[model samples]
Target: MISTSKHITVFEHQAIKLNQEIDGVLFDETRLKALQSYYGENGVPYYSLIHNGVRFNEYVGVIQVGETIIEVLPKADNSLKGSNEKKRWRDILIDMLFAVGIFDIHSPSNSSLKLKSNSILDLYFELFIKEVEYLLHNGLVKQYRKKEGNVTALKGNILFGKHIQQNITHQERFYSRYSTYDVEHNLHSILFKTIKLLKQINTNVELHSRIGALLLHFPEMPEIKVSESTFEKLVFNRKTQSYKKAIDISKLLLLKYHPDVSKGRNNVLALMFDMNKLWEQFVFISIRRHKEKQITITAQTSKYFWKPESGYRSKIRPDIVVNKDKADCVVLDTKWKNLNGYNPSPDDLRQMYVYHEYYNAKRVALIYPGTNTSKSSGIYLDPITSKEIDKECSVISLSVEPKIREWQKNIYETFNNWLTFGNDNVQKNKNASL
Candidate 1:
């Protein structure tokens, strides 16, 4: 709504007024209604209804309603100047996604150039197209699927009842259920459905030619309805493993897309990701990829912490657990919000305290994304003695660098330095030092 060009940029938690000119973006009432309807039906947590507009939540990505694009970017600071600032955050979000393996850019083609000039939706669409093109050039895999129909010859198994009913008049024909190895399988079905969707929702002119080529060259597959369970039930081996990236992207696009059956004007295609989850994944992957060979990093490793008298026990899972030589363990909880002057919520502090007790960790810290790189340590106090205890927790801020590689390196070094503090025997003899 910044212009009448149908493209608008908004940050997380930002809202734009509909049918009224606002400072930031001016959303249309009709489009807002379309999104409101979609939200009412889907109940996705990406946005919520406001007075006259919609307020985007913690999810960051591009949302397209009809031909209009609403790009929701991540903001860790209070700087929201103009288009330049929006571009910076947009690029940062995309880089974070790529670094965390949300989408691959290892072997970028010409389509990669469009990333800077286009929205995140276009980026994903282009990636899917690239993946499909790669699959086409390499040749798609064939799987054995059951086929039921009239056949000229006998095959795996014959449906005698159907044969007698349908092929009774035709002496040479037989109704048979047979197995044939071909490209008409679930994988192809998913890919084909995604390609068709791209053709419908994609507005990027640069990708149209490639998409057309995929439609022409890729094997024609039967149309089938795909749901979340379809992708969940998928299995892959060595032969089908190469399709993993493509299928993963397909699942994201296909599942997030909702067609407009009532109006056909505002078909929504959302590619939003929860900022909290993204931050957690980014931190875990960064450390695991760069940490020392002796260090072992695990994520979401759960342990039962509380057991009810007659029900299921509660499990506690830290964002990341770092173990060194199987001797020292460090528990880390990654938070997406920046902690400027405010202390972490009591609930979070309590959660970390529980993790320390359950995991028997040497150290535990809450990780947050911030502009300044610093660490502040705190200790739990004895309830009766009102004195500091040995158990410690720290709030560490890993500086958000423009370059992801440099930021990842800083995360590795910052955590390594923090962990080194626990290794000093002399320091262990004395009170914990900052």
Candidate 2:
């Protein structure tokens, strides 16, 4: 029974305005009068129809008149470009309209759309901005922190100690520490494990080739030409064809002839070793030749403490040692693990402490792999100097993202910083002596 009271033109489109009084009212006076006149004064009821095919179900017979009329807008026929074209533009437009606090196109019974202060796109942009800021502020290669535990020695065997009276002796033992450096070491260890696996299958020339291909993208290796019998004896048919065999043979050949792949890898390792040696040379040159400030780095250079005067010599090698003048030094040791994101054991810390005491170093740093939250640098207190020194030793964790250039930068910067710290210490000591 709704009837149009007025018409308006907007954007060259005609829209109808209905009388507000007729809202929700069936058989209004105007409609009833029209029906009666159309029926020619007959008492029988006459049905009336509205012109528009679209139904106004909610309002029924009533229509609220307004200055601005409701219009059926034409659909946009043009296609959206790029990403917009991949999705429905109409749906996106509708959502955008809802997001901006415009009229809701959903069910009327539903609650009003609540516009968020920040959209998903805004949040994504913020995250990207933060990542970019981190990359800019901190170099691609940076130091990370690791958590390590104190070391304690193992007690006597209680396997058959039923009475257990005399075995109650207390011995200094170390437990593992939780650190980030351990995590990185573990990651490297995985690479080492993969290398080990490839070594095991080295006898199977075909398998070796496949492994090499899988691990590296270098050119194919020239096939080793040997007598069929010798090849069978050395490689194909073996009682034990495990990875251990491959590693052993590879090591043997590396020590003997210096095979190309094995030799190249060894050379790279040797370079790392040589770099350790060259650090001293670089420092000396930088100071003496270039007239720059004196710098020194510390590493584990001695192998005496690990050896027992009475029993078999322990084959422990210290990772790194930093010496700044006579009094200040920092010792660092690296360990590789097979687990993901593991912390150092207490035994490791004890070993480090032993190095600290033997070398008279001020700090003992235990490095490990870094997780997301543990990317920052941190220091740990030495248990021995807790009362006297307040800060005895430091345990730090570093993050490595596995890029060649990044690795080089990390090594350079780390050594450089160590040198700088050592130089400062030397100056302070010189002033004190004066």
Candidate 3:
């Protein structure tokens, strides 16, 4: 039997010692081994194993080891370690994820999901459950599948060799193959696997009843060995399109889950996201949503930079590129870390410089999460002459707001204003380029 469930919350880069009791929760040996083995197999860099404990990296999410739950949350607000701060960042992370289309919840009624959920895992489980229940309410999609079995009546094509081999003794039975339309298919199989996984790892009492109902009502599908490619092979049409969201969440939950085969002590399920990548996506999507009709906002637009004598060529892609009226382009790179009253790093500045020259961008900026919303301008200096060049790069700090919509609006407005006026030198460069 499992021991009493313990929930521990830690911020990014925080460490928890193994074989120790803290905050009234014990980080026992079994749980630590489970995590260690998981990290060994996946090597995700979500956490690093230390001499005494594990330190979580920039990947923030929830991981379950047996009955123990570890929730690692993102921390951009400095070293303020408090429960209130944890809750605040947790909500912010979820909101950012929602904006970036990570938590693809389709239910109209679930718009306020951030307010009701206790953890990110709970939110995922609940969203998946709702999706499955919706499909069950409407009906499962059926498809034509070829099946072979022994039958009394001659239906489909019958193989004389197999018929004689098996049905010789019983002349009434005929082994025949036929195509029957049914709900059994790869999509349902994936969903069923996700349901079983949720049944095992889910600890939320409120979600238990809903999960049970899904298992009871959902069609029994063949168990499949799910992989990253398994989801890649799926093809959705009109009939299967409704299952897209559910299958997406399923793919995430099923793929990240690693079960404990030895001693069956701890099973780890990590649902972590790289804050840097998430920040980039969130900014791009937010701006795209509210940008002017004439402006074009694209993310990760790649351009071949260095071509080698042989093999693959090097490519450079900025996080976001905005083209205004197809005349001037602005590049924006997002970083999740706080600048803390320091100038941007030289490497970062150099990257922005390349983006400026390669993309011919009117301006480039490194966006950072900060307490105050502000922007600073800097010009590149000539390497030999020590004179300022016409090129300009700026650093913009955006304050995280309480509401996601307000935050998104702030992103669009701030980005729009920056693109319009820019710095004094950037405006001059824009006029010079035109």
Instruction: Please report how far candidate 3 places residue 209 from its true position, in Å.
Output: 1.3
Candidates' RMSD to native: 3.6, 35.3, 3.6
Residue lDDT tens for model 1, 224-340: 988988988999999988899899999988887888998898998888899999999999998898888888899999999789999899998899988822548889999999888
Misplaced by over 4 Å in model 1 are 1-4, 20-25, 105-113, 148-177, 324-327, 422-434
Show model 2 residue runs off by greater than 4 Å.
1-300, 306-316, 337-343, 372-391, 414-434
Q: Per-residue lDDT tens digits of candidate 2, residues 272-313?
A: 012122222322222233222443543436665555668877
Per-residue alpha-carbon lDDT of candidate 3 for residues 273-318, written as tens digits (9 for 90 to 100) = 9989998998888899998898888899999999999999999989
Model 3: residues >4 Å from true position, as ranges? 1-5, 19-23, 78-81, 112-115, 324-327, 424-434
State which candidate has the highest TM-score: 3
Return the TM-score for each candidate structure.
Answer: 0.89, 0.28, 0.93
User: Which model is ahead, 2 or 3, in terms of lDDT?
Assistant: 3
Find the number of clashing residue pairs for candidate 2: 50
Candidate 1: residue pairs that collide? none
TM-score of 3: 0.93
C-alpha-based local distance difference test score of model 2: 0.33
Note the residue pairs that clash in candidate 3. Answer: none
